[model samples]
Target chain A: MRLLYFAWVREKTGISSEEIDLPAHIETVGDLLRWQKTRGEEFAAAFEKDRVIRAAIDQTHARHDAAIAGAREIAFFPPVTGG
Target chain B: MIRIQEGDFDLSAEIEALKDSRTDIGAIVTFTGTVRDRGSDKVIESMTLEHYPGMTEKELARIEQEAHARWPLQASLIIHRVGKLLPGDNIVLVATASAHRHAAFEAAAFLMDYLKTDAPFWKFEEGPDGAGWVDARETDGAAKARWSAKSSSKEEPAST
Candidate 1:
């Protein structure tokens, strides 16, 4: 699976994207956020306020509760500020 | 038409293309968002727009499709610039054409409303004070929420 971070999340996390094996227990986006905190300090800081982060599964907007089963791509970013 | 590019665009040329040989279009509405120099208390030096590559195009196309499904649109165009930009530079453009003024105006506004929230672009502002990511404004949410209310009310009449 591939994970993408954008904007402030990218800056905070210090990477734009990465490919990793889907963890067996991480079935939902919320669970992924929780697990991400154990990765490193940057990941913890990037997801510190998990609720404020928006997510998309395979490029479609999704809620944190949304399942990530069989997904190839997941993206996390701050709420958009574009006009 | 949907374009996500780093280069500047010609507005007059764009309008001319949209209006070419389309007699069915009786009205056209267009909007452009520009980078402003004003910050809270300091003058803004520059603004940078960041967006997802494949996802950005998909979302913009989806917004355009939604507008067409709801309105009698002859055509529509969305052009959003990415990368670094200075004050007074065009940030985004939305143009809609329909046989009636009502559809044209409403669709144009609808496009912008959706783009504000739905699009993945993020703005980072640099100024004399400091540089920071622009907040995900609540007012932008309020602006987009109005349409949801309208849609729900529209559905109520049929559900009753």
Candidate 2:
């Protein structure tokens, strides 16, 4: 699976995207956020405010409990500020 | 039509294209969002607009389709610019056309409201003081929520 970070989340994570093989336990967006924090200090800081950070599965906006099974791409970002 | 590009768009040409020789269209409403020089604290010199490559277009198209389904619109267009932009530069444009003024006006507003919250775009402001990401406004969320109620009355076709 591919993970993308945007805005402050990107800044904190220090990389825009990465390809990772998720462990069996990471099945939901919330689960992925929790597991990513344990990867490194940068990821820990990026997901510090887990609720504030938004997640998208397969480029669609998703809630914390959204399933990530078979998703090709997942993105994390702050609330959108576009107009 | 939905366009996401780094280059600025011509409002007049876009409106003309939306019209496309259709004489039945009675009203056309447009909203343009521009880069502001002043932020909450600093005088912003430039702003950088970032967006997801594939997702941005998809989201915009989805909202545009929703607007069309809700309103009796003759045509609609959305253009959003990304990358570095100076103050006063155009950031986004939404134009809606219908047989009556109310539908055009309401659909344009609806599109703008959805774009603010649902679009996969972020704004970063830079000035002499410093640079920071623009925070999402609660008011924007409120604006989008107004359309959640299934108000069939608002979707009435234009008689004029």
Candidate 3:
């Protein structure tokens, strides 16, 4: 699956997007966030405030509990400040 | 209509296009958002608006559809600019046309309130001291919440 980072989340992660294979244990957006924290120091810092980081599954806004199975893309970012 | 581009848009032209020689429309309401020179603590030199391309358009269309579903609007337009922008530059424009003033005015406000909190765009401010991402305002979420009970559909508010 492909993962995208935006705004401050992108800055902290130091990369905009990446392709990664999800571990069998990771089934939800929350699970993916937890596993990402263990990847490296940057990922840990980027996802430290996991609750504030919003997630989108297949370009649709998603809650943390949303399933990620069969999802081609997922994105994480800070709360939008657009108008 | 929904347009997400890096170029600036003309307000008059947009309004004219929305009017589109439609004699039935009697009222048009417009709202434009511009970049501010000052942040809460410092003077901002510029702002960079970033967005998710495909998702931004899709989300705007969805918001527009909701506005149409709730009001008797003849036409509507949304234009948002991205990339680097200096203070005083226009960021977004929304226009709604209807046969009456009430529907046009309300729909324009509704679109803006929803866009502020739900759109997939972020602003990064640059100042003499440094730069940082603008924090999402609590008041924006409050503004969006005001419409929940009145909406025809009972969907949960998007997480900001």
Return the top candidate by DockQ: 3
Instruction: Supply every candidate's count of residue pairs whose N, Cα or C atoms clash at under 3 angstroms.
Output: 0, 0, 0
Better of 1 and 2 by lDDT: 2
Query: Under CAPRI classification, how is model 2 graded?
Result: acceptable
| Cα lDDT of model 2 by residue, A1-83, tens digit | 99999999999999999998999988899999999899799999999888788888888888888889989999998988888
Worst 10 residues of 2 chain A by lDDT: A50-59
TM-score: model 2 vs. ground truth: 0.94
Give the Cα error of residue A64 in candidate 2, in Å.
0.2
Native contacts retained, all candidates in order = 0.63, 0.63, 0.63
Compare the candidates by lDDT and give the number of the best one: 3
Docking class of 1: medium
Worst 10 residues of 3 chain A by lDDT: A56-65
Give candidate 2 regions above 4 Å deviation.
B149-160
Model 1 has a clash total of 0
Candidate 2 lDDT, tens digit per residue, B22-101?
99999999999999999877899999999988989988998898999999999999999999999999999999999999
lDDT (10s digit) by residue, model 3, range A1-80:
99999998999899999998888999999999899899899999999988889888888888888899999999999999
Candidate 1 lDDT tens digits, B44-134? 9999999988888988998898889899999999999999999999999999998999999999998998888888999999988889998
